[model samples]
Target: MQQVRAVVAKAKNAPVSIETINVPDPGPGEAVVKVQACGVCHTDLHYREGGINDEFPFLLGHEAAGVVESVGEGVDTVAPGDFVILNWRAVCGRCRACERGESWYCFDTHNAARKMTLEDGTELTPALGIGAFAEKTLVHAGQCTKVDPQASPAAAGLLGCGVMAGIGAAINTGAVGRGKSVAVIGCGGVGNAAIAGSALAGASRVIAVDLDDRKLRLAEKMGATHTVNSRETDPVEEIRRLTGGFGADVVIDAVGRPETYQQAFYARDLAGTVVLVGVPTPDMKLPDIPLIDVFGRGGALKSSWYGDCLPSRDFPMLIDLYRQGRLDLDAFVSERIGLDDIEAAFDRMREGDVLRSVVVL
Candidate 1:
């Protein structure tokens, strides 16, 4: 076992503390990663707030890139010194989804069998099974997807989660194609990434909707062709006006609220897709839209889990695109800080001041 510095949340709605934790040697199908960078995502904050679960003393931080330090006896996919993006979804081949050849929807995923413990020997729950806010972390070998080493860790790490979710929501779930029109609701990190993904997929018109003008501008920089300040105008109507007075071919709701979802439902052209990539809370209720509207919509209303991405395939491809300068992953990284700044980063995230604050380990 090796002692590593990590940020841990001891209780719900409480600040995280930086402390030393013991990471065990890699066991079967596991590997130890020397973390290079980790991004502060909303999910971490949710976990800290007990919104995710009552798993107290949660190790918070998931979106990450690192170098493989060691691998277990049976691990062969990645070796020591390989640059990798850590993924939360470690597909278990025996799962029903994997048996159906849809590993992306793997019902049973793998994590480290051994636990990383606090100084007092209390077992710690690594966030998303990746507790990457540390100098080192242990994970299932499948969770470490090799990527281009040339890519900056701060930028590439974003692809491990939010960026990938947005891109895959458009490219895979929404099936955005050449000359298609796409409108993305909520222009935060995920929504802007969707806009960029739509552009990369050859969508001719990408409309960005957000209440904040700042985010809307950033969305345009990320390849949105049109911007809608939802605070000033009705997004559904604006999207229609921008897409030839009809509606978008794909409308993605990156904001997981009933209001935004309703707008997304109405902002797509007939027979077009409405992809929900954003997460919703249990307290939220759906609108009483007539069942006739659902039938008349004539298209799929899908929810994308982690954008339906197969990490092995998508991670390297995205990193290659970033290298080619076609996909600007760097734009998503608003700032970089150390692991100790994670709590402050959470404050900034709540204030809607930055897209992503990465921790450079």
Candidate 2:
């Protein structure tokens, strides 16, 4: 066992603190990773707020990139010294989804069998089973996907979560393609990523809708052909206008709110796709749209899970694109920070002051 410094959320709504936690050596089917960079995502804040569950003293931080330090017996997929990005979904190949060739939707995912602990032997539940905001973390060997060593850990790590979700929402779920018209509602990190994905896929018109002009400007940098300030104008109407009195070919809602979802539902052209990548709270009810309208739309309403990505296939390809300057993964990283700055980084996230504050070890 080894003790490492890490960030932990001790209780609901409590400020996270740096703690000395014990990480065990890799057991069967597991691996130890020396985390190089980890992104501060809203999901980590959600865990801190008890929004995810009542699991206290939660080890926080997931989206990460690292170097493999060691592997347990029988692990051959990766070895020590390999540069890798950690993924939450370690798909179990025997699951029904995997048998059906839809491994990305694997119902059974794997995690390290051994638990990290506090000094008193209190077991720690890793956030999303990663808990990578440390010098080192142990995970299921499948969680570590090797990528090109030339990629920047700070930028490449973003693809482990938000950026991948956005791109997957566009390319995988929405099926956005050449000459398509797309409108993304939100303009946050995930939303901008969708805009970027749409552009990369050769979409002719990419519209960005957001209440914050600053985020809209960032969306432009991510490849939005037009911007919509929803606070000033009706996004649905404007989207239709921009698409030549029809509507966008694909509409994505990254805000995960009822109002924004409604806008996305109505902003697509007839037979167009509506992709919901935003996570909604339990208390938030689905917007009431008549069954008649749902039938008349004649289009698909899809929910994106981890951007419907197959990490083994997507990660390396995306990293190569990032290396080639075809994709701007670096733009999502608003700042680089140390572990001590996480509490302040969460504040900045809530205030919408930054896209991502990455922890570089």
Candidate 3:
């Protein structure tokens, strides 16, 4: 048994407590990772709020960078000392989606069978199959994606979740390419990442829309050619005006609200693509939209799951890009704090004060 300090939400809506937890020895399919850094993502907050499920005493961190400390008997994909990024989705080769060669949508993913528990023996539910806020986390070997070790952990860990989702919304779901016009609504970590992805993909005009001018300015640094403060102006109208009276070729909704979704739907050129990467709450309903407009638009509507990322394929490449100074992953790391600062980080996130507050263990 390995006893380690970890951040855990003991009950619904309770502040996380830092405590010593017992992590069992790796089982047949597990590996233990010494977490180096983790990003405070909104999904972790959702889990703490009991929005994801009823699972309690959650080990609440997922977007992380770590080093392999040990492996189980049959683990071979990664070994001790390997530098890795932890991903929640671990593709199972025999799943129906994998059998069809669409491993990105693999229905059955792998997670560690071993359990990490509190000192009193209460089992802890890991956040998104990866309890990474701790000094060390246990995970399925496949959850560990190897990447270039030279990249900063603060920056690379963001790719494990929100950043990858945004980039994938454009490149994978929207199929954004060179000279295509693209607009990203919502300039948070995910939205800005989409804008950056659009720029990297060679989109000719990348327009960013958001309510906060602070976020808009940050989006500009991420490669948006134009920004519209949605609070001050109508985003759909501005997007159309910026694109020569025609809507953009692609629009991404990273806000996941009815208003933002509507904007994304109408801000695309006829036959253009709309990609939704933001997750909506369970009770949020789609606004009344005309079915005729949906049919008349003649465009694709796609939802990106983890940015449609194949971690093994995308992580290494993106890290290399970051190393080459092509992708500004570092721009998203607003501040780095110790593991004890997660709750404060959440507060900062709630107040829209930072893109990402990283926990550097």
Model 2: per-residue lDDT, tens digit, 94-123?
999999999999999999999998778888
How many steric overlaps are in each model, in order?
0, 0, 0
Task: In angstroms, give how far residue 12 of model 1 lies from its true place.
Answer: 0.4
lDDT of each: 0.93, 0.94, 0.93
Sort the predicted structures by lDDT, highest score first. Answer: 2, 1, 3
Candidate 1 accuracy as lDDT: 0.93
- Estimate the TM-score of every prediction: 0.99, 0.99, 0.99
After superposing candidate 2, which stretches have Cα over 4 Å from the reference?
Answer: none
Candidate 2 residue pairs in clash (backbone atoms < 3 Å) = none
Measured by TM-score, how close is model 1 to the native structure? 0.99
lDDT agreement of model 3 with the native = 0.93
Q: What would the per-residue lDDT of candidate 3 be over residues 1-361, giving only the tens digit for each residue?
A: 8999999998889999899999887889899999999999999999999999998989989999989999999888999999999998999989889999889998999999989999999999999999999989899999999988888888888999988989988898889999999999999999999999999999999999999999999999999999999999999999999999999999999999988999999999999998989999989998788999999999898889999988999899999999999999999999999988989999999999999999998
lDDT tens digits by residue: candidate 1, 205-324: 999999999898899899999999999999889999998878999999999999999999999999989999999998998866788999998899999999999999999999999999
Better of 1 and 2 by lDDT: 2
